[model samples]
Target chain A: MTYEVYVNVLPLKGLLDPQGKTVHQGLNKIGLSQVADVRVGKRIVMHIDANSEEEAKSIAEDACKKVLVNPVMEGYEIEVAQNA
Target chain B: MTYEVYVNVLPLKGLLDPQGKTVHQGLNKIGLSQVADVRVGKRIVMHIDANSEEEAKSIAEDACKKVLVNPVMEGYEIEVAQNA
Candidate 1:
């Protein structure tokens, strides 16, 4: 089976996101007044080859722990499509 | 006009992503040996309130430069849809 994985990687709350801050400042410079609270993180969409959804989830979760996310500094969420 | 924006946030090349490394390790531990590489990032989807696609892109780009991303550590890609 094949699965689609949506991954969100973000720095933990309270951590300094220099990138987000810079982007926020840029918005003001460009006169984009409506943009409020710009926070930046990574979004990854992947197609996985697996035997089942459960197996795929387990693999993805493991990948999240080992390579996709740093539990200490970042958090991640992974969702696998059902009946796909 | 309203626009649909798809944003991808990622760590710059050559930067160490501890989170991505951890997720890679987790994948191996979970018996997902087929997984090759795990790079962590953020994905943001937003509906923009704008008068035109060009305006929306400008706004989104400004946001990316100021708040959505750190120019030093991260890179962002924003795609605004038309005919929506």
Candidate 2:
């Protein structure tokens, strides 16, 4: 079976996000002042071959922990669905 | 009312994502070879002040069109939720 995994890696709360700040400033400059705050993150979509959804999710989590996510700066959430 | 909006900006299908490719190769090098494919995109989370959920979503879409997304090369999806 193949599972489609979506992983969102976001900056930890209380950490400064320079890219988000830059975008916020740009939005304000462009007259979108109603945008109070912005946070920018990464979305990673992956296709994995595994026997079951649980196995696919586990593989994704391991990949995130080992290579995709920066534990000191970011946190990740994963969602898995069986690919049709 | 305040609304939390999530905007996902992704490369259009058939477009090459260099970052995704790099990460894919890294995963393979790390022995997660079961990963078949990967696509990387951007997630933008915003806090907006608006009169209603519909209004908030409209504002976010407008922002995406004006500054956040490149229509020719990328596509975007917006999700809105009322902030408590």
Candidate 3:
């Protein structure tokens, strides 16, 4: 079986996001200008294997806690795509 | 009203993702290990205002093209969350 996951990546609270800030500045330069506090993060897609939905979820959750995310700073959500 | 958007973040095709690779290695160390070629990316959330769905989408698409994404290297998809 196949499982697909969606993840949210963000900087640690109080950590500087110069890249995000730079993009915010660029937004103004382009006249999309009104946007403020633009923060940029990453999204990842993964395909995993399991025999049942519950099994897939368990596996994915463990993966996130163990390797996919750093719980102290980053946050994530995993959806076992029904289509998968 | 309110509009919510979901974004997918990824590295340029040829760019190296050392962070992702590191995580992949860590996964192996942890026995969640079957995963290989793990590539990391980001997901972002945004709230926008518009009178109608079409208008909100147009504004968001323009924003993506103009500033939120660098079409040459990055890719994104905007979903207007009905729950918004």
Name the best candidate (by lDDT): 2
For model 1, report DockQ.
0.28
Candidate 2 segments exceeding 4 Å error? none
Once model 1 is optimally superposed onto the true structure by TM-score, how far is the C-alpha of residue B5 displaced, in angstroms?
Answer: 8.5
TM-score of 3: 0.74
| Highest-TM-score candidate | 2
**What TM-score would each prediction reach against the true structure?**
0.58, 0.96, 0.74
Q: Write the per-residue lDDT of candidate 3 for residues B4-79, one digit (tens) a residue.
A: 6555667676877787778767777888743534567756555556677776677668878876777776766777
**Residue A80 error for model 1, in Å?**
1.3
TM-score: model 3, chain A: 0.73
Writing each residue's lDDT as its tens digit, candidate 1 over B16-71 gives 87776776566667677655555566775455678888887887776666656788
* Candidate closer to the true structure by DockQ (higher is better), 1 or 2: 2
Clashes of each: 38, 0, 6
Better of 1 and 3 by DockQ: 3
Q: Is the docking of candidate 1 incorrect, acceptable, medium or high quality?
A: acceptable
Interface DockQ of candidate 2: 0.88
For model 2, how does the per-residue alpha-carbon lDDT over B51-74 read when each residue is reduced to its tens digit? 989889998998999989999989
Per-residue lDDT over A1-84 for candidate 1, one digit per residue giving the tens place of the 0 to 100 score: 667666777777788777766665666577776555445667765556788888777877766776667788887777777633
Models sorted by DockQ, best on top: 2, 3, 1
Clash-forming residue pairs, model 3: A42-B41, A42-B42, A42-B43, A43-B41, A43-B42, A43-B43
DockQ per model, Cα: 0.28, 0.88, 0.44
